[model samples]
Target chain A: MAFLSGLSAFPITPSDRGGHVDTAALKRLVTRLCTAGVDSIGLLGSTGTYMYLSREERRRALSVAIDETGASIPVVVGVGALRTDEAVRLAQDAKASGAAAGLLAAVSYAPLTEDEVFEHFSTVARESGLPIVIYDNPGTTHFRFTANLVERLAHVPGIVAIKNPTEKPEEISSHLAQQRSMTPKGFPIGYSGDWSAAEAMICGADTWYSVLAGILPDVCLRMVRAAQNGDVEEARRLDATLSPIWDLFKQFSSLRTVYTIADLLGVSKAEPPRPILPLPALAKEKVAHCLTLLEQDLA
Target chain B: MAFLSGLSAFPITPSDRGGHVDTAALKRLVTRLCTAGVDSIGLLGSTGTYMYLSREERRRALSVAIDETGASIPVVVGVGALRTDEAVRLAQDAKASGAAAGLLAAVSYAPLTEDEVFEHFSTVARESGLPIVIYDNPGTTHFRFTANLVERLAHVPGIVAIKNPTEKPEEISSHLAQQRSMTPKGFPIGYSGDWSAAEAMICGADTWYSVLAGILPDVCLRMVRAAQNGDVEEARRLDATLSPIWDLFKQFSSLRTVYTIADLLGVSKAEPPRPILPLPALAKEKVAHCLTLLEQDLA
Candidate 1:
């Protein structure tokens, strides 16, 4: 459970054009996360294209990541699906495959009711016995999780934590405080959106659920460690230094930007599943430029 | 192509909890649409829980619907998937199975760019050789289609028409006019959202992509016929008469409400795929009452 409290790195699941998991390439990514010592490997997250993969492919990805991590780093698998039964089956697979927790998003196509989402989370948790992290990602799923709903789910038996979307830097403190006050004491609250995640962690958020960390874990880990040690100035300095990469992330979503970075670093050369194209050439140039800047500054 | 012009009924694809299509139940629903003389059958639409079913199940539904309708009606199958290649395959299946056209939504998990969607649609249309209807469903997909994007896609070789989400009733005329002015001449523009569809049809939108019509084709056909014949008063009257059902649709979603209606009317007893629960007891009672009122009034 404590593994859920630090820098959880979400990696892109390396796959071919046909959506089959490149298990060898995926293990390479997981090896990188373990080498950098990310607190947990967020396998099959949105960044991992969990929604695009078949259940068998997802199982393959999780199995590989779990095997690669080898009890050194916990793997938090994304078990979200449009159907509840499918999610339950996914969570079951993650549990059986040795994932530490299942990150469940309210992945919807019907624009689900809060009650339906609650029942969904509750059902998956109860049925699968996998510790669940409530993944509140509205940017993709379009289902926003309100504080009330988050608090309610936080109290559910197997629902242990939340991975909230980032707030504006100035709002991070209050957002964290409000969420902290609403949920059970000591229940971990994490933040995604790499740009603002430093501020969120500096504001005493429990974890940084980061897209950048998925590929560039060492620098992200430095930021998380700085914030963890209460070195607010050091964390802000790293945040400021990474501004160019953050700008790239903002421009060409973190998912696409990191895919380019992973390829540039020779970690994995897989394009995202289609409907999600790789960054265009000019964007790739910008991402490369940002990477060069990050290497110079972070070094 | 002309069949895309009038009352295009979107029936729910009846399926068990496991996402297998109930071909018998589906055939019954399609038979009703055809017997009631709907202009076209929109198989595997959002109301059909197309997003929830597997591609094989989708093919089974489309195949059954096409066979049930025979040559009497054109079946526009929903060919949407999170992956572009999968969508292309679905479109190909629809084409090979004798569907008249493929209804392609910009279904996304990564929150696609307009350019990505343009490519996704273009690729499916080009690769499958199936005529495509741009399914602009922002409510479910959360990917909006601007008029500019629609104009561009409308010009894509195999892309034939669009099924836009409902606009405000008062804005239906201007919305229709704006869309018509932007797209190629005679490119069919349709509206879903059963409540506003009558007004949209009266405003000269080419089709009513109706959820209600999927189950209750006769009454909806009367509304469409009235609008087509330039009897705005009669269409509006029909719209007003169905206000209660629309209200239920607004409250419980047309998909959920229609499922209850289908069961009550002995059309199909299948519930929506999980994560989209059926109407609860109170809501079911309301739906049953509205059906009684509608039966008395429409009869």
Candidate 2:
């Protein structure tokens, strides 16, 4: 697949026009990503609005992505929920869908203590042989994982990488350094915060969940490769071009903006699943500007 | 079963030794509440840890509380979920459990916008037929429900009350006044944010959700009665004993102290459902002290 080493946009999969799994469009999207040289597909993930999809939709989406991508790239499915049992069930579902690994968010109802977090991850990791990315964005957990917790979490088997919270670069660097040191050699340590991809890579994050990669895959892949090659000048230049999309993410809730921008780009034009805020008028314009830049320049 | 109007504990439906629903113990607890003359039973609710329990467990807990209490008081069952369908299902389940009404926390995903919040409450309210209470406390939601949003939501038919967030008295009051002006005349608005009951009551929040009520129902009811009777001085003195309990809720990420205090007081010793944090050492001591003081000085 030549997909394991570079960049891919964590594309937000659109809901079906008829309000279910858009399997046909999903195949089209998969074919598009494959055509664009996206290294991986994080299907039915946070970017794909995993929480909004029903259990059946999640399974269907993953199956379709796997079928269309056809063993070409690894698919990191996001298994997040308020129930560990449900999360584990989804992990098994992901496996059956031909997932390469699971990006499991530690779903706690009443914020779990550090020990419970360890247990939550450990339990899920044990259920599947697939390498599990312990998604440690405490912003969702509402219980931040401290450096000590990271040290402790690193020891759990099948815990291959950490997709950490990095809205702030300083905190991102702190996390990247801690996880990098604690992780075994060649273990994937990724950043979910794409805003600071260059710095995250510079600080130590080897892999990233790039939101921009969905619309601007070539640009995102070029930047990641440039950073990986230690070509700082080239990485920064590409990042500058992708800056408008990055700025738009800051204008709304990061997760919601991922879908809003996708909708604007024609890559994913379906309505956001219910209970998610639609982009505001001002921000919708910003999304248009960003999409225009991508279509005319980056794409 | 002459439950009066005032603050009362959210009863934790005692699980049998092997984690089965304990109807016998539940009746005993009801006997105690009846003897103590509590205002109402908050059952199959958060203190009830409703989400962690299976739908069957939720039904059993609510049915037992209702069967024993037998229309002598109101039971507000907490119904919340990540999806509208589940919330509606639980709301119907709450009605089946013989609850007076269902109190719904906003869906679990972070940053619920105004539209999502409106849909969440409206969906639950329309389906339940029972009176509705919108539980809006960011301590859990991590996303505040603005006054404007609440004002709009207050218009949903069959919605009877607002469980308003009261972490700050002045802020809660400002919102309360705004909501009251916009809402229907009879819509009851309650306050959440422990240890602020007196201030909440004075500042247009006529109803109070007392954490201490879960353990020290007698004292909590008395305090609410005192406040309702225009005896602010007496209410303050009663509220004084609850300071330690509020301190404990603030101390931990897991909120283990909430359930532990209930256990220590001999109200009902149901183990916290999984994914909950354990009470920290100092918080446990503080909770114990609060329970002891309630028994000695108020209960």
Candidate 3:
């Protein structure tokens, strides 16, 4: 299997009360993820609050993850930014930190054309030594990459993998078709939508970039392993077990809900960046109930 | 009436073939809007491609617009950014550039909370010497300001007005109701959804911050004037005449369509920044037909 395949844990970069990244907590979390027998780890992802942190904070977060992981598994750092120059700078920093790959989203406040999206990635790819995983999260970027655009980006050197967020099942299938027909053989594609991971995996995604894996590495890994073994029944059973949590993700942003769950599970004290508050009281009750069910099922 | 009242023209920031801001063309456009009798001119709006331009480029664009207008009308500069410090810097620059007011959207790649929204504007309001118009453009920002949040922002000393983009009539009515109950009376609410301006005005908006006003200032002003004079029938008649163009705006982004129309009218050679292409060929034909129909109506 490729380094990018399997359950890659996107760990939260926990912060201090003063809103600064807590390097000690981050290191501890990375250590946990690395030893948890997951395939890889991703730092500075949306779950990592990459956009909300300062560049220096992001660098420190990546460096801590890399230093602690230290070749145990590949580390991918999110280098998405508002401008090409800023993204290039972050990608360079990630490369210097010895990250194996840089994850980039064509983030723009203004709407971007397909050509502009191609240029943004090509520029970052040219500047960075690490391989790039195109992060296609249109819900946040508001810049949707058409299958045609993704096919065009696949031709860019260093863009070796893709992490697609949830869309309709047909949309995912179309993207898979594009990847199959347009890209070279074995260009690993992963699914980031936790709720739809089993369906995506069944549709031939090479990996599951699992947010649930951040805390429940074992549980998430079991689901991916089932899919890998072609046990569709078992995969569906595992996904059904986690459907309650996924339902919560659909109601509120995963970033906010995950922080609340992490707190409940005694995993991390990580909170989402200010302006993105933790789940409200009602949502928290639902999350607690779901977590209880998850724990009960595992028990 | 306040400086923000009546029709505010959001002029496009003209750019040359090489994608540099055409300051000379921008100045001429500003001059035309000012002389055409717009109540105010909003430079560097979303229509101004504010996010695509560099800070220095944005500053130059604002300087040219302010210089060209020369106090004949208020020049509201869009000072929104992804980072709070960057937004503060833009607001400071807008103040230094002799702009009459600063227009700010809570632009973010990460979703922001109500408290974060309030903090962002309060910080900018403290630093900016000019009056501030809180731009509630959730479509672009992905950060919706709750009615409670807007009521809170209204209490900020320099946040003198609100320019709400188009939402459902019920949403607009609810927001207006909240404003009426929460803020001090006559807090200068305005509408930016050009297609919905007459309807928003009838619901008690104080002005229209219009993209159409950039090209057809007279027609936009006539609609606003009709609403102001309690002539809903006349306003609906005028709006119906422009429904063909409004339908085009609905089909594609107003930004791309406006650039094409501006080109057809010999106003400016301004194009959307790279990645936001010009109107496709079929859309161009539709736009041309709409323009022809509009010309005959005006004649």
**DockQ, each predicted model:** 0.90, 0.40, 0.29
Quote the RMSD, in angstroms, for model 3.
4.9
Q: Where does the lowest 10-residue lDDT sum fall in candidate 1 chain A?
A: A1-10
DockQ of 3: 0.29
Candidate 1: what lDDT? 0.91
> Share of real contacts kept by model 2?
0.38
Give lDDT tens digits, candidate 1, residues B163-184.
Answer: 9998999999888888888888
Best by lDDT: 1
Best first by TM-score, ranked: 1, 2, 3
Q: Is the docking of candidate 3 incorrect, acceptable, medium or high quality?
A: acceptable
Model 3 chain A: lowest-lDDT 10 consecutive positions:
A269-278
What is the C-alpha lDDT profile of model 3 across B59-126, one tens digit per residue? 98988988888878889889987666677889999999999889999888766767778877888789
Tens digits of lDDT, candidate 3, A241-295: 9998888877776777878877887777776655456677898898999989898
User: How much TM-score does chain B earn in each model?
Assistant: 0.98, 0.87, 0.96
Clash pairs (backbone) in predicted model 2: A9-A213, A9-A214, B9-B213
TM-score of each: 0.98, 0.86, 0.78
In angstroms, give how far residue B181 of model 2 lies from its true place.
4.5
lDDT of 2 by residue, B160-277 (tens): 7777666576576676777779888767777766667778876646677665565556777777777778888888887776666666667652236756765666665666655454
